[model samples]
Target: MKPKVIRALGVVSALLFLGVLIAFAQPKGETVKVKGEVVDLWCFLEGGDRGADHKQCAISCAKAGNPIGLVTEKDEVYVMMGLKDHQPGKEVLLEKMAETVTVEGTLVKKGGVQVIYVSSVK
Candidate 1:
């Protein structure tokens, strides 16, 4: 039809295509359920400090933007992070430090480090 209309349609189509490509290019993770005690990764890994005595410290560290993690009953630790939508998983972890809870999330592992993009906790 009109030249301007044709150009606008072409630009719109290109934008839609680019959006789909970016969505597909994002990394995907396996859904998993992990049971563990939430801990501040800094003190937990650096000095084995965790559990009841370390609960307040863990919460403070999380509020200060330090990374949090889960220590499984089996002794496996998975770094806690927000979901792909950028949901702040640390907030959830902050409430449960030194307390065992079940976490549902997308599990991603790379370079020998494991992380959980948390979705739910109970």
Candidate 2:
């Protein structure tokens, strides 16, 4: 084989390999499903009251008795309480964390944590 031809093939192969790696590295913004026992509910409301200040809401929700937080077998954590349109104490079939009974929504990184904005529960 000609040296130039061999060099071209090598470059092509390298480009192809890089493309594949980039494709896999990108996060697919698809909803996934996950399932686990109801852990702790991290409610955004305070003292079971919906009309609380932001800081108060956080503290109150933590005190309220509900499973707003979810944990998977892999120790992935999610906060479900006080999100828009989501109800507390309701069983869910999450999507993004599909390794278990969880269902999907966009998994976002907030404050150095991975959380899914749950779209539905089955």
Candidate 3:
């Protein structure tokens, strides 16, 4: 095999490995104090109203493992999850649905969708 071809193959291999590393890298989210109402993202996205009135249904959806988000006063919804073990925590959010609460966590953005990884919820 030609020396140039061998060098080119090595370069390609390195690039592929770099790509894999980037793919596996944990995304970084800015730490923020987010004050909002826990909401069922499925309902919020579908033009459903969320407030004291929708509390029961929102809690039900959250309890059922549906997508949950924090709907800020500005009307922005951020998908919420527990930072511990990097998994969703619907139980912590179930009763808080449609109620105002403060969440401190890292805000991460992927594929144009914003998500907040909660370190603590209150």
For candidate 1, the per-residue lDDT at 113 reads: 95
Q: For each candidate, how many residue pairs have backbone atoms clashing (under 3 Å)? A: 0, 27, 0
Q: List the residue pairs that clash in candidate 3.
A: none
Off by over 4 Å in 3: 1-27
Which tens-of-lDDT digit does each residue in 1-122 have in candidate 2?
69999999999999999999877654444456666533434432223222213334433444464445556666566665322444433334222121234545556566776566666654
Candidate 1 lDDT score at position 41: 92
Error of 2 at 43 (Å): 13
Off by over 4 Å in 1: 1-18, 21-26, 85-88
lDDT of 3 by residue, 1-122 (tens): 69999999999999999998876654576899999988898888887669999888888887777889998889888998877555775846776888899999889888989888887888
| Number of colliding residue pairs in model 2 | 27
Residue range 49-120, candidate 1, lDDT tens digits? 999998999888888888999999889999988765554557667788889999998898999999898888
Cα-based TM-score, every candidate: 0.81, 0.39, 0.73
Report the lDDT of model 3 for residue 47.
74
Best by lDDT: 1
Query: If ranked by TM-score, best first, what sequence of candidates would result?
Result: 1, 3, 2
Weakest lDDT window of 10 consecutive positions for candidate 3 = 83-92
lDDT of 1: 0.87
